[model samples]
Target: MSHLLELFRFCPVCGSEKFVENNKQSKRCNSCGFINYINPKAAVVAIITNSEGDILVCKRAKDPARGTLDMPGGFTDLNETAEEAVIREVKEETGLTVTATRYLFSLPNTYKYSGLNVPTMDLFFECDVQEISNLTARDDVAEAWFMPRKEIDPEHFGLASIRKGISRIVGK
Candidate 1:
């Protein structure tokens, strides 16, 4: 979030935060003629399904959709493969060990947060849980559960990627 960056006065070009917004989009460093362009972050998540054909969803513990249900996924780490990120996110959020079967689809969505454009390229994967027990929420997740596709409320879901993933899987 840009607000998080505002706490610093170092120029991004020279680690100096003495900068000001030129108009409404670009930032200019007073010390140096350095201009930094803000960009969006990418996040990856899984649409995990059990043998019973129920899709896994977690209650978000953070904003953008706090308390809303979403698939177990988040920002992809540096140097981490999409598959690795999905598997790790699923386990971290739901406490369920899973193996990624395949990538479902990639969705690009944008939302505003902290006065900055938060755009995300959400990479969705279809995964199968190895063992369903020992479930507890972690990684900014309040709760996790499996729900039949037909029973999921669209309005309660955090993003369209989640809804689209469920629709695609259940339709097959």
Candidate 2:
């Protein structure tokens, strides 16, 4: 895995090549005394279930893990709350307008993107959508469907945190 510190050849604040590792989690610009912390990005995961107790699942249309089972979610945008992000992500990926969300739990994950292993804190939420009648896959989802909780196999989910979450929810 490529270290995030290695990616920073220059300091953002001073545009100096003196940016070096300040510690395990940050890079410091010796020229201007600017330190950039390598913090995990915040992401939201929506666990939506149908009235019949089937779980909503999406097929990833893009890689990191394309053609695999996933939940509707994405990284939170700047200046947005986690709740808002979940609602937005659900709509963008599943065409479902989330009416309510209850925070569940969070897990650490390593998302490989652009040849870099980006760390993320994935927050899980139990979301209620307005309706599933119009649940068409959109955005980065190739397809979306609901499976009975008993039929869900955690191993089918490519992401580690998601697999764990599904296991916990299904008691599998």
Candidate 3:
């Protein structure tokens, strides 16, 4: 969780290691009046299914899961709503524009990556693509294609959040 060190740290005000948990779910420095809060991170994922029920999957080009098939999604930026983040991430990775049809579900997941514990709150949405064409992969994506639900392999997926999202859709 060293990566978390940048986000979580000793309160500058109080030198005491002992801290109190605040009602708002934050740690208050005991010595000095400093508060440390764990901010919730938003990750938006797209469950893109066509009229035939085929879903879009992308091969990840970066670590966590390089060369693995997963849904197109990413972290939501500040000031951007979850819906907007889903649409933007899908377009950025798959070159397809989609309309968020409905909210699917949210999942809390954690994993160790690069020696850091990454905790994420994933917000998923079922979306409809406006058009289907030959998708050119972006920097973070190696390739994109529509795969049948039965053909997905959970073991080759990038993250648990993605695997769980697909499981909810396919009832696996």
The TM-scores of all predictions, comma-separated, are 0.75, 0.95, 0.81
Cα error, candidate 2, residue 2 (Å): 4.6
Which residues of candidate 2, in runs, are more than 4 Å off? none
In model 3, which runs have C-alpha deviations exceeding 4 angstroms? Answer: 1-9, 12-27, 111-115
Candidate 3, pairs of clashing residues? 14-32
In the range 18-112, model 1's lDDT, one tens digit per residue, is: 78775444577888888765565678877766677787778889887789888788887999888888788878887888854587677777655
What would the per-residue lDDT of candidate 3 be over residues 84-126, giving only the tens digit for each residue? 9998998898888885458889988665557556678999899
Please give the RMSD of candidate 3 to the true structure: 3.5
Q: lDDT per residue, candidate 2, 1-172, as tens digits?
A: 4457687799999899999888877899999999999899999999999989999999999997899999999999999999999999999999999999999999999899886778899999999999999999999999999999999999999899999988988899
Candidate number of the best TM-score: 2
**C-alpha lDDT score of every prediction, in listed order:** 0.74, 0.93, 0.78
Query: At residue 64, what lDDT does model 1 achieve?
Result: 76
Which should have the higher TM-score, number 1 or number 3? Answer: 3
Candidate 1 deviates by what RMSD?
3.9
Q: Which regions of candidate 1 are displaced past 4 Å? A: 1-11, 14-35, 111-115, 160-172
* TM-score between model 2 and native: 0.95
In candidate 2, where is summed lDDT lowest over 10 consecutive residues?
Answer: 1-10
